[model samples]
Target: MPSLVPPVLPGGALSGREQPTLYADGALTLRPFRPADAPAVALAFTDPAIQRWHTHAMASADEAVAWINQWRVHWAAERAASWAVTDADDALVGRVGLREINLFDGVAEVAYWVLPEARGRGVVVRATEALARWSFEELGLHRLTLRHSTLNQPSCRAAEKAGFALEGVERSALLHTDGWHDMHLHARLTDLA
Candidate 1:
């Protein structure tokens, strides 16, 4: 029920006021994730596509609650943060997060996934782009990175369309459900800044 717009600030992007909550190609409001979002998160993770690409088991309702709760702890430490991406109707369609923040290097790894219902509609692309821009500009981060198993074409495409250039492939980088395989690393720098 709370507003998603940022607080007042004076500067370039944040100049004189808020950077738009929305950005990129579609519903780009990457706002803070709330505890109340647990139900939707639980539902989204339950989807087959999400579970497959994530290479993990589904989360129970309580696990989803703890996951959402950690967003606050991560935010407080400036180590990482997560946001719920919503449609104009304010239904949560996905989530994106900046994880493993390295302040000494001013970098963070970004991750995201769209619910099956939201895929192919540019939801993840918009959310990721918004999060990347915020990371480089608002958070003063120098770099943001993302990774996906090469077998996941949709995720790789979303990353590319969101302005992340494919960096390289790490062969046998992870043990996915399909098997140990390469991971495509992608990134967007602070060049716009």
Candidate 2:
């Protein structure tokens, strides 16, 4: 007798979501992950730094392919948007994405990583800034958050450099292979003006 779905959202099937092909900010570009990136993804995930912070290690390119498929699934569901970060030469350097999206609340979480060869070059900072700006303006998100273990000083620095101000620390926020780690929460809000 009644349809209770919100007018702003589709009721039956979720469709009409735009999947971006490329997002560029000057020298950096964000594109969807490709199968060709599996080997690179495998190599990057094997890095001790990536494993320590991200807590997921890929032993082979097959696992990397699976991971990429999972990201595709998430995108199809409108649950997350993942991207491959690249340099001007189109070489894969890192990754940045908006995860945990809440359209109704206009909130999302930002996550990123940089390959070992790309470290110390501000890859993540630039990529994240571009992604956050796109999320705020194009996606109509009001706020974006970045969370990283307090032990990850590099990540903390990148978050700050990307304009995400530290909000607070979440005690024992994440459980890594080592143990529970405190997480620093950082956020950026859209300017309504």
Candidate 3:
């Protein structure tokens, strides 16, 4: 086993099975999202559940390509990275991202969503753990934050399953299409990760 991300800190427990650019457990793979993921990502984002739960913006096919291109730009800039989640058969089922990355400080926010067909399969949980383990072990992040719209119970459950503790709620702080809503805050330190 080796470091999954970068700057593998001294004494970190990195797995030799995980590659520097990506990591996988069982059928799930977490790797840098490429332009090839656009089609699958587009289809998943258009899912109504994803729209209602995650507020995915309406986008045309070309827009999806543009969005994916931005992900690549970020990857090149070392500001952030997105990973496409796949199943045992290597079918794209979801996406996860580590956004607002501050590598020098070892902090990041985890974001993820699974397609309708992928939900209830624990895909998000597995993807999250893979990324978190990389952040804690390879990147040496001290903490990770997860925020879920108060209305999203499933996300809250997923956060808990990923070892996050509810810190509190940001009351009516999140502006939505309908109105303002609370956002539940979840945090986990590297030690817990």
Candidate 4:
């Protein structure tokens, strides 16, 4: 028996074409991750903040390379997509990506983090806005959600600046190294009108 409503986005919606490099602004670009970026990724995991929130650390460059390789698989599978956030000179400054993509529902979760040097520069906000635009317009997604620990003030601020509205808090929704954290759920819908 078929359901009355069909998938909002059909299969091959993302895998049909190559993942294109997205321009966030004159100063920032979102591009596919390269093997050379393993070092930067390994270095990023060493940051306590990244480790604490993300709950995983790359112990070596090899591990980072493997992690980078999986993004291609995820893209082909249409389950997720990730990009390296680079500066104008093409230096890896951060990362932004969509995870838990569901074509049927046309939704995905957004995640992002920046190197210590890249913080306070609004890089995440710009990258997120660019991703959101592509997700809604090019990918035909219905909704994009951004969630972060309530303690993560910077992430909360960035989510708001990127036009994600705060829906509510999920109490003790995530487990961190320290303890359970309350998560703030924010969302941006394609049809805001």
Per-residue CA lDDT of model 4 for 1-193, tens digit only, reads 9989999999999899899899897589999999999999999999999998899988999999999999999999999999999998999999999999999999999999999999999999999999999999998999999999999999999999999999999999999999999999999999861
The C-alpha lDDT values of all candidates are: 0.76, 0.83, 0.77, 0.95
* Top candidate by lDDT: 4
Ranking by TM-score: 4, 2, 3, 1
Give all candidate RMSDs, comma-separated.
8.1, 3.0, 6.3, 1.0
Better of 1 and 3 by TM-score: 3
Q: Which window of ten consecutive residues has the lowest lDDT sum in model 2?
A: 6-15
Sort by lDDT, top down from the best: 4, 2, 3, 1
Q: What C-alpha lDDT, on a 0 to 100 scale, does residue 150 get in candidate 1? A: 91
Candidate 3: global Cα-lDDT?
A: 0.77
User: Could you tell me the lDDT of residue 60 within candidate 3?
Assistant: 69
Model 1 per-residue lDDT at 16: 30
Each candidate's TM vs. the true structure?
Answer: 0.83, 0.90, 0.84, 0.98
The model with the greatest TM-score is 4
Give the distance in Å from residue 43's predicted Cα in candidate 4 to where it truly belongs: 0.3
Residue-level lDDT tens digits of model 2 in 1-193:
6547533323212225556755556688898899989999999998999999999989899999999988878877767888999888888999999888766567779999999999998888888888877776666778899999999998998889889999999999899999999999999998720
The collision pairs in model 1 are 11-15
- Decoy 1 TM-score against native: 0.83
